[model samples]
Target: MTRDLLGRHRAVLPEWLALYYENPLEITHGEGRHVWDAAGNKYLDFFGGILTTMTAHALPEVAKAVSEQAGRIIHSSTLYLNRPMVELAERIAHVSGIPDARVFFTTSGTEANDTALLLATAYRRSNTILAMRNSYHGRSFSSVGITGNSGWSPTSLSPLQTLYVHGGVRTRGPYAHLDDRDFVAACVDDLRDLLGHTRAPAALIAEPIQGVGGFTFPPDGLYAAFREVLRERDVLWIADEVQTGWGRTGEHFWGWQAHAHNGPPDIVTFAKGIGNGMSVGGVVARAEIMNCLDANSISTFGGTQITMAAALANLNHALEHDLQGNARRVGGLLLERLRAVAAQVPHVREVRGRGLMLGIELTRPGTDEAAPEAAATVLEEARAGGLLIGKGGGHNTSALRVAPPMSLTVAEAEEGAAILERALRSI
Candidate 1:
């Protein structure tokens, strides 16, 4: 049955849409941190549907809200007044650190980033953008232009003149040998030099934790230093929180908080997990920047009633249950366990990330070359051992990404860790 579906999927889906595992398994249902395949084989879900299922699988609160809203009205477009949309926006604005903020909804992260680029360029009167190396923003044309990961970029032609910067990935860059303080100085110096060479960039957009870049991040306060530099020339800062928002980082509610000494970013874009599966994405900016455009703008289906209802319930439940605190407690334990196990394996080069968003990078035993084959092997072995994980990296795809739902339990973490350890040992 799975084979037949796989054949149909390949025939219809784009070739670039990659699937996990040597033989893909069909998930039939899920509850809590576990999922069952079509064959009824149970597996601990460590990836959480690419970190989209933020709270848990089959979360009752979100499902109930979505169902109730669908019964009343699914979508009325942005032409009508939306109570749920206004409520969710108010809550998000209060939580967002930006002063005098306004929100605009989109259907996906790609759309959110695209809106951000449009605002930045129109406000600053420049089309050039500064992006970080090894960063992955989204798949849209504008978002893809800013993406620094070569593996994800499909075309060289882009609408924006993008200049890639350093410091997003701290471990494998040219300045990796430097200490934390020196590393910041070097990256800042590089940024200043790059700015000197290029036209004034409209903005510098970055992911607090480069999600598709294998969960890599720079030293804390690295962006703060860059903020000071960009502030002098009025370059807007955009924080892409699609993967690191809602306290996934454990230490802070938002990933940008780790570098909040200067203040919140000028524009914040979010998606993934906000609706707990519903397609909800948005951008938050100060009213001045948000309203710079002279022409009218509206996302016809962006702030639909049903998605807003789902996002409101999901966000409320996450806040009420203190899922951020749960992530800090449980994810710390999981990270420690994975680090201990990784030390015993020679191919595991680095185990990094915060909160529930963690990554284990695999490389050849002696050389610095990436071991993508080892990552693939471990993914398959973990699946066979009744655990589901994900893989990502630079061009090689050699990093194991383990980001379970924020509401993970201690017992579930241990079980997933054991399975992952055995999988790593197999390689």
Candidate 2:
């Protein structure tokens, strides 16, 4: 509604409902890689709507597909077959290389993760799930329980049945002090120890490239080792590509491809970029696992005509434009430029990430603790200067997430970086 309405609701709503920015800007419209506020001031959309709008805002094809679908038919219960849903599923499976994969659609990333968890637990008949620490899955009951962040806790959901494994800490990079071989060995050892200490787990879930946990990229060989361990234990390996999927990471269509040596995961979840800012999420699970999930295990507003049409259109657009390739080229340029900026400003701790999903971590001049306050000041200043960014990670650590549309140009990236450079200088 209105800004005043948000403020009023903040006072009366639960903390969860009020967890967003205290003073949220009212965006009126968006096109390509920018958005205009109600007052008509434009801001470069570096955050890409939390890395969801891979194709950019107000994409003509996406809008047209949604409109046509709405005019034709919007919803039909899962009781009957739907063309858009069937087509989207085929496209997803084809792109994901999970032939014979079954698709289950949902309204949001959280729902997809929730469905994965439910199916994993039921299929394995095990109560324990292993998830990486500092990783984020979703905000729903089961998904939140498995998430490593403390923010998603205290749910009414019963049994709290998940185990936590140590994610690579930010003390340095993913392989900070170790070589690839040693890192892989250590991960294998850790998984073995974790399993030895507890009951067998139904699934091991992790973000291929940590998103909310500061865009941490794991070391080479680590994923392969983890996958090996999961295979040995007959544990399902669930790759949560909610933030890194849809060619955002450049090298692959999904984040897991960045770690290709690990082989295919038992189940993979997608959202954020699937519908290019519209609401759509789905899971691609191995045929065996899909068959194991009881028929009608989940049901809701999934695979609706409007959402399916948008998803199909988005997929087609991504394939036609080779957005993944664009993500690689633009992301490399952005990272190179940001690294240069970081060098100029000693306060900038590190710049990392693949493809378009990048993060700039600002730290105290001489301390390890992130300068979140400084980051916030810079973010506000950048917004004022016409670039929109986002912050995440535990403690709201000084990590600025940069995930612009794959269609974002080199010039835009350069300009956005310059604006950010000025913001950093101001701080």
**Index of the highest-TM-score prediction:** 1
True-structure RMSD, every candidate: 0.8, 2.1
Candidate 2 weakest lDDT stretch, 10 residues = 167-176
Per-candidate clashes come to 0, 0
What clash pairs does model 1 have?
A: none
In model 2, state the lDDT of residue 55.
92
The CA lDDT of each predicted structure is 0.94, 0.82
Q: How does each model score on TM-score?
A: 0.99, 0.95
| Residue-level lDDT tens digits of model 1 in 268-380 | 99999797788999999999999999998778889899999999999999999999999999999999999999999999999999999999999999878999999999999
Global fold similarity of model 2 (TM-score): 0.95
Could you tell me the lDDT of residue 126 within candidate 1?
98
- Most lDDT-accurate candidate: 1
